[model samples]
Target: MVQSGLSQPEKVIGSSYNHAKFKLLTPSENSTKTPEICHAETIIVGGGVIGCAIAFELASRGQEVLLVEQSEIASGASCAAAGMLAAESEDFAHPFMAKAAHESRELLHKHKEQISAITGMDIGLRRSGFITPFRSYSDLSKYKDRRNTTSGVQQLWWDRSTVQREALWLNRDTYGAYYRSLESEVLPVSLTRAYARSAEMMGARILEGVQNVRLVVDNHGVRGIKTAKGEVCCKHIIIAAGLQGEQLMHQVGVALPSSPVKGEIMAVRFPIDQAGGRPDRTVYAEDVYIVPKANGEVWIGATSLPGRKDHSVSANSVQRLLGAASYWIPGIKEADFVRAWAGIRPSTPDGLPYIGKYEQIPGLYTAYGHFRNGILLSAITGRWIADLLEGKRAEEIGIEALSPERLNRKGVML
Candidate 1:
């Protein structure tokens, strides 16, 4: 289901290489001899944050889970994400989304300590908060209701003077800033690897570099999946393959209307003692965001170009992002340029993720179209999907609004 225009696979050397460091499967590896057919309770397609998290949850709950990935884990959007857990900052047009995001953020915070302790990986989970600067009061008025409805979130409206005092590098035109103290950030690649490692430790079979994957369906329901390596016969199949999920579902006569939204981001480094030393929190202004890592590297992103599939970093996007960054933090102009990269994020018409069982096919489930929130919602999506498969009610888990049926009922063409 992981489709790419690049035909050849990248070469990977080691067996236990981290997803962030590993390359794709080589040509010879893709033609390896098929092994014997395997069986599992559930087969999850895709190895991004969502899939890895789901695998971790299901395996931890004692379910026999097999995760198949066409490429290395977290090699997609998960690795490119800025890792902002912005439940409060996100648009909550649908009340249920707000609830789900809130719950997901809580779960992320709750498990941050435990996961880091177990894996000994610094996930860089920080509750350093997020700030959205406003150029005018009219701009602030537009999101007043949304900001107020962020219940249980610590919200503060800082005056221009306070903003200048806290973030001295901001532009003079900045009027004020709305701060959400509970919003957090994490190292997405580290988190995904941690989840995958933890799931494997708990008996989940994760197969990477698997090519030519196809779903095995029967008159009753989805039987399992077949890959270049071998076949996996399972009771259930989950499609969390991000942008490629639509194509996979279409193979089974289901129309999943989703598109790839391309985003470009850049990382800039600064000396520890420099005036541009990493900011204390994530800052958003004029559709650009600056996320600081503990290592004095600031991630300034991102340009969201909808309906774009190419992951090529454009000069225009990079110039625009850097200009915005310089406008927000004057010192950013002097920071050392690190690298710029791009990713294609999956999105739906309504900007809501599809996270439930498909009615047309039994034992077939989906957890894709998360758009920009995949990393933020990964923990709760996994937990809820595992819960649903384990016989928990949708209403009980409060994810009824995220059902796939909503898209079908709307009659949106795939």
Candidate 2:
């Protein structure tokens, strides 16, 4: 439910503090009389997968959680994701990041059924293997010898004949592929909705369609937040607002370097009944990835353009994506074009999401800059947030590595 925004500026009752002023547009009657002063143990901003998952995790731990969003949940990068729960395919700068992804995917495996049961929404979580076709033999030759010793991700070598038997449609010039059983697929929107709905079932409150969001800070730390939908008083605040979340963090002077990366993806109608059938599993080629959806449309994507904020899909980008996919799976040339869209992913300079507390500001934390792994990491990110808030930490997840202050030492903080 969306709360009404304020019509004018309202003063917050607190001592001298640093707060940004964004005009609220709520019912003036309510503001002139008494602003809606609700209370919660924690107030989470941004209703994407990360925000919703954090709400669910906190509620599951018996914490009163309130989430506020400027738009509908999952309308950002969360919904735009291709929904590949990938760990091995991603070339991580840190081994712990990969390990964290593996653990997060496991969390999804453990909680998907329970969330679906509570929300009555099929989250579409499946154990679909992922294949990364290698263009040259030297690349396949290396992975053939050993697995990822650091992250413990299993690997296998699939010869060209094996590829044909498994995915007959992929009649390409590629020599072989590196296969990993850990990568899975899910419906991004469905998974995000399931998390949000389950959180509501557990008594968590969600406010959508809010605007002009700004935090109320004091000497102690975050006091509460003012929005177009009145005000909320809380002890803790976690910003998971995706791309737009950077603005809030910047205003707070937390100095976490965050940027945007745009990814354009499309779906095409595949004729499954044709002579050469489609692959049962997802395929990641050199230039593109093909994901089979429940609606018989093979979702092929995407073109990653960093330092971009807009979601406009360029005709040249579409042509490049389609051409690359067709080179691998010739059926794509004949497949009917469906639709295409774009999403701006939140990214950081070092490529690691900021997950821990900012010691400079107590009761302030962040789960932003997750980039493309937001969907895959949402579950574990929530668990980590809960752990951090309760004066706890998970060593295996590398809490310090994801700290918001890690990059500040390099003097990159804004």
Candidate 3:
């Protein structure tokens, strides 16, 4: 048998490259000899929120984990997401997503202090609540009855007077509005980076620029990954590669039913008091959201453009979001736009994430298909994947709703 794993010498020879756009720290020059084989308890492909979260959980539980990313952490949809944690704002018709979304929020709230302590960064976790204003009385009346999941959940109904009192910058000509206290917001990139930092501190190896080409499954199960460089043998493999899940699945003869749904967003800097109010909450209005961050920057976005795979920001998308946002805020038309970016969300046909193992592949599991909820759901995704890796039942969330087996029944082409 060939001796595998990084030799002692190779560890010393890698060099670090630092540039504004990107950075790479190569294996040391005295890097240990590249072993003919590599081994770990788990190998996570992708460095986005899903993979990083799984890596963090596995490493925390004393499992040797390897997280390979084709690009920098938070470079995928995780980076482009607006970080809204409102299961209510999303389609409530899907009970499974609703439950998972709520549970994920609970998990994020529970782990806030620990995450801050470990990452030395505030996750920009704001429980400031969310307000959805309406210019149409018909729309206002639709939600005026105040319907939600639980009786304990409070939905604040705001008439014109209340909106004015709260400094909700609606033109006096506006109608009424509603506020959901359960909804909150965070800076997605910041939160994701914190997870990556914590995972690295816990002894997880995060290798950027390392693309996983395929999984190497032996007679028993997944042995490791076949990367551009070489094979990495691992006992368990997690496919958290976002929209790339189907391609990876093809390599192993399993059909992962997934597709890419693209969206674009723009970032802007604005003074806190520009809205003529003391800000304490996020504003979700007119199919757009205005999230105030602690750092004096606000993220307003996210126009859903279905079927666009390229990550280029289009003029129409920028104009449309800006127009819609300005219609809600009125003042945003005067604000200076800072930056714009796009990402392709991994979407399932039914809009729910796939978060369990393929029944055919013993050691292979999946945690992708998050779509727009990827950022908000990352915290719990790690724990859920960890449960599967440990052969324990998922407590906070039910996996049967999102089981890989369920997607197979949909008859999607491989």
lDDT for each candidate structure: 0.79, 0.77, 0.71
Cα displacement (angstroms), candidate 2, residue 284, comes to: 1.2
Query: Judged by lDDT, which candidate is best?
Result: 1
Give the worst 10-residue stretch by lDDT in candidate 2. 1-10
Q: Pick by TM-score: which candidate is best?
A: 1
Per-model TM-score, in order, reads 0.88, 0.87, 0.86
The alpha-carbon RMSD values of the candidates against the true structure, listed in the order shown, are: 5.2, 8.1, 8.1
In the range 1-414, model 1's lDDT, one tens digit per residue, is 222222111221113433333222334444434333357889899999999999989987999887888888888788778888888887765767777788888898776776666666566778898888988898888767445475655779899999888877677678899888888888787778778877877777787887778888988998877766657678999999988888898888778788988888888877666754457789966578999875557888888888888877777887899898888877888888877777888998778888998867889999998999898899999998999999887788777888887777777545
Error of 3 at 110 (Å): 3.0
Residue 275 of model 1 has an lDDT of 53
Give one digit per residue, the lDDT tens place, for model 2 in 1-414. Answer: 111111101111112111122222344544443324367789899988899999989988888888887877777788678888877787665788888888889899877877866766676778888888876788666655544453476878788888766667776666887788878878777777778778877877776777777888888998888887777778999999877767898888766767888888887776656625566678876578988765466777888888987767778888899888888787788887877778778888888898888777888888999998888999999999999888885354467888877888777666
Model 3, range 98-162, lDDT digits (tens) per residue? 77777778788765677666656677777878888888788766654544444334577888898
Better of 1 and 2 by TM-score: 1
TM-score: the better of candidates 1 and 3: 1
